[model samples]
Target: MAEQQKEMSFLGHLEELRWHLVRSVAAIFILAITFFAFAEQVYDHFLLAHIKPDFITYQLFCDAFQLFGIDSAFCNVSFADKKLQSIKVTSQLMNSIWSSLILGLIVSFPYLLWEIWRFVAPGLTAHEIKKSKGFIFIASFLFFIGVLFSFYVIAPISIHFLYNYQITDAIENSFTLESHIGLVTNMLLGVSILFELPVLIYFLTKIGLITPEFLKKYRKHALVVVLILAAIITPPDVASQVIVAIPILILYEIGISVSRRVIKKQEKNANKS
Candidate 1:
């Protein structure tokens, strides 16, 4: 009877999880359909906006150059014969569908996080759930901030640098639509997840896998790794790499602080218990 009760309980949890997942999927699909309905605006003003020479970043660079009384590449207003091509017949349709889904995922991130939290909250102690009351909000905020950072700073810089780079006069710089979208989407997703470092650290600390001392002791090594990661993710330029690395380093520091706080809280709670 006890074994049967355990099985039923497990089945009930699974049923609850299924509903949460179903709701999350429905939200994503709804948002994706909405994005698809306005795909042109999304493609123009959001995705391909950085390809223009007069993008906000370039304008800022132009202003900075003028302030220094120097000639600037920012004045170069034309991309060299850059047109996006789709080699396969279904490529455009597939790309559009995937892009819409990506946009949906981004837009619905907070709600998705909420659903996940709701699903998991029942299993957690009341105190634990209370302790993490702001998790969804903070995580969503960090994610959106990271996405903006990627879109405004990293994506534009990377696109401009790569589009302008030339090895020989023989090669032209016509990019495929898939390639361009892939780069933008990957950077957006990657940076947003990277910004979750503090939250990840909190959980790790709670589970006793990490401590403040471990993070502090390896801080220098972490810096080097962060720089390398930034170099890998951003354009092959010092400025771009530095811009990407700074936020990640800050996140690492924040993660260390979060770990320390979690440890302290756990210690206090233990003493009280």
Candidate 2:
């Protein structure tokens, strides 16, 4: 079993943790300032890109459907005159600041993970630490992939469907700036965190809190939960829900493999000892 190198006083641990948190915050602050400098461009080009009818995702969807000789609704939608409303006087400025901060956190995630690992490494056994050397890179890669998947695939589809859906022609769709930003950022961050399932499962297995058999037994329940999560994150449409659920289900399967590997390694170590 892995063991701590040495015991540290409670205050000593707290102090070390404080410094790691401070550095992490400083990195986020620096990136936030940089993003704020180019706030307009970031908002227009990246954050609000889906609002445009000709965004690459929509075009991709159009092309994909065209390959089947089928027409896609994405190609027919237009957002030329549509504008997100700013009801409050401080809405724009506040939303911009918050959005930049969120972007900073997202961009600086790898650094944040490194800081966390540094803080935790001191208490871990050398073997454990060495084995986890790729934690930061792997976690960051999964997170960024999740962000891209959500942004390019889920976000635009949900946005277009929700924005265009109306009960009657008498009612017009007017989305607020704050609401729009909230939706975008939530989906980006939320899905990114969800992508850490395999990592989380690895640790859980290492701690003996869960095993491969347990995960396999609960596979059906996991599917139901994934579907529920998909419903929450996506617009109220079967196609959108299925689209979101597929990746999460894939992650859950990956987590199962991770758990199995962890159990096999543990058994091998036990036999060797």
Candidate 3:
């Protein structure tokens, strides 16, 4: 009888998890449909904005150089004639659907985190639940910050450099729509995930997978990894790589502090027990 009851409980948990996943997917689907409905505006105002020569990042760079009484390539850049080609018959339609889905996932991230919290809250103590009350908001904030940073700063610079760069005057830069969108989406998703390092550290610390001392001890190694990641994500330029690495290194330090706090809390709880 007890074995049958245990099996039923296991199945019940799975059912509950399935429902949570269903709701998350439904949220993404609804938002994706809405974005697809306004695909033209979304692409023009948001996704493709970085490709323009007059993007905010370029303008900021121009202005900064001017303020310092220096001439900059940013001031001379122009993208009025550059256009993305649709090489495949279904490229536009497919990219529209995929971009809408990615946007949907990004916009619904907080709600998805809420759903995850709801599912996991049942297994946590009151103290743990209270401690994590702001998890969704904090995580969502970091994610959006990363998105904006990549879209405005990283994407514009990368697009400008890659689209204009030529080994010689003979080779023309004609890029496909798929390639352009792929780069933007990948950077947006990748950097956003990277920004979750502190949250990930909190969980890892709570589970005893890593400690603050371990993080500090390997800080130099982490710097090398961060530089490599920056190189992968940013344009092949020292300035771009440095800009990307700074924030990630800051986040790593923040993660170390978070891990220390988690250790302190766990020790306190152990004493009470």
Candidate 4:
């Protein structure tokens, strides 16, 4: 009887998990369709905005330099006649569908996390639950911040360098729809996932897998790695590399702090038990 009951219980849990997965996916699809409906606006306003010289980031930098009595040739760029083109008729249609899906996933991230939390909460103890009470919110907040950072900071730097780059006066820079969308989505998702370092550290510390000391001891090595990653993601210029690397290193330090707090909480929970 005990064995049979355990099997039934296992199946029940699996069924519940399946439902959660279904609902989360359903939400993503629904949101994706909604975005696809307004695909033209999304492409023009959000996805391709960074390519425009008068986009807010470029404008803000131009204004800042002027206000501070600095002169930069980059500020006087002409955005006209610079547009991404699709070589094939199918490319535009395909990218529109995929880009909408990506945006849908990002916008629905908080809800997706909530669904994950709901599924995982049942397996945790009261102490564990309390300790991780803010996990979803903190994780979602960092993810969105990373998305914004990539969109506003990294994307602009990359677009500025790439769009303006030319081999010679005879050559022109014509970007394909695929290449443009690929770069944007890659940066957006990559940085957003990287920003979960603190949450990752907290969980690792809770499980007694990593410590603050370990992270601190390897800090220099981590800096090198961060710079390498920044170089890969952003423009090859030192200025762009430094801008992207700074926030990541800050997040690593924050991860160390989170690890320390997780240790303290684990010790307290041990004492209570």
Candidate 5:
């Protein structure tokens, strides 16, 4: 048994990971089927809610602007006249299916992470596993926060900008079903993954792959990268980019602190051993 364990190859690990992925994918599909049953309701009430102008985010921003007697576009924004087109016969159907899958992934994210944890935890020492046990909750929390931020903040800005961007009065903005859903889903997934920075740093620190000093040393570079990411993910506006970058920068700082704590703990553990 000892020899068999010691002789485990890369293929063995890959096989194990494959099973974990299969399980995770199965969970997502099950959830997707559930969402698919209410596809129309999900599409209108949840996915397309941001484009309604009466979304909670829009209202709050409008009220905030009004309270201070400031003029803002959100104050007069209206999406009642807006419409989504389906050029292809199958576009609407495909979008509904894809959107359901994305929603499934989001809804089952915690379970997905739990599946990942089960795969990886066995490779770590008991102490390490115990220390990192909160990985699922923390990761899920960050992911949800990112999803909410993207939906309420980034999605609104992008939708507003694109919907109102008129080159000429003759040209009408007719967004396609695919394009609309694409933007929202991309933003949701991208930010959700980005928000897992601290969790990522903790793992890297545990494995001696990174240190707080290295993060500090490359802080400026990380800022540039974060800003670039913010620009790519958000609408082309300084305010929007800044808004997106602030939280990411803060996450990076928190990641550094997490790294420091991890390193300190490892050193203390080694000394005790």
Candidate 6:
């Protein structure tokens, strides 16, 4: 009887998980439809805004340079010679659909995480569930922060630098629309995942796969990797790479702290047990 009950419980959990997944997918579809409806405005005002010379970042930097009595590239109002191209007739339509889906996923991330948590919560011990009560909020906050960083700091700088770079006078710097969108999407998604470092470390530490000591020991290596990652995600310029790297390094340090806290909490729980 006990074995039969256990099997039934397992099946029930799976059923619940299926429902959660269905709901999450529905949410995504709804948000995607909304994004698709406003695709033009999204592309013009949000995605392609960086291409304009009078973009907010450029204007702010230009003002700062003037105040400091410096001749900055931000003071210049034009890209050297670069244009986005679409080689196929279906490219624009395909990009619009895919980009709307990505936007939908991003906008619905919090609810998706909530559904995941709801599905997993029943399997966790009451104490464990309580400890993770703020999981959805923290994860969503970090993810959005990463998204903003990628959009405002990483994307604009990278676009400006790459669009302006000239290897030779003969070669034109025309990029494909697919290439530009791919770059932006990758950076945003990558950084958002990266920002979950602290949460990941917390869970790993809880399961004894990570430790504060281990993180500290490999800090230098991690810094190098972070710098390389920043360079990959941002522009080739030193300033751009450094700007992107700083927050990431800070996140790494925060992960270490989170690991320590998790270790301490586990130790306390064990003692109580």
lDDT to native, each model: 0.88, 0.90, 0.90, 0.87, 0.88, 0.86
Q: Which residues of candidate 4, in runs, are more than 4 Å off? A: none
Per-residue accuracy of model 6 over 87-168 as CA lDDT, tens digit each = 9999999998998888889989999999989888877999879978899999999999999988887888788787888889
Candidate 3, poorest ten consecutive residues by summed lDDT: 232-241
Which candidate would rank higher by TM-score, 1 or 6? 1
lDDT of 2 at 57: 91
Q: What is the overall TM-score of model 2 with all chains considered together?
A: 0.95
Q: What range of 10 consecutive residues in model 1 has the weakest lDDT sum?
A: 73-82
Q: lDDT at 208 for candidate 6?
A: 90
> Per-residue lDDT of 1-273 in model 1, one digit per residue for the tens?
999999999999999999999999999999999988988998989888888777898888788899999998876756647788899999888998999999899889999999999988988998879977899999999999999999988998788888888899998777899999988988888788888888888889989998999999999998899888877766678987888889989999999999999889889989999
Best by TM-score: 3
RMSD of each: 1.7, 3.3, 1.3, 1.7, 2.2, 1.9
Q: What TM-scores do the predictions have?
A: 0.93, 0.95, 0.96, 0.93, 0.91, 0.92
Better of 3 and 5 by TM-score: 3
Q: In order, how many clashes per candidate?
A: 0, 0, 0, 0, 0, 0
Clashing residue pairs in candidate 2 are none
Residue 30 displacement (Å), model 3? 1.0
Candidate with better lDDT, 4 vs 5: 5
**Per-residue accuracy of model 3 over 164-193 as CA lDDT, tens digit each:** 888997888888999888889888887888
- Show pairs that collide, candidate 6: none
Which portions of model 6 miss their true places by more than 4 Å? 1-3, 79-82, 235-238
lDDT of 4: 0.87
- What global local distance difference test value does model 1 have? 0.88
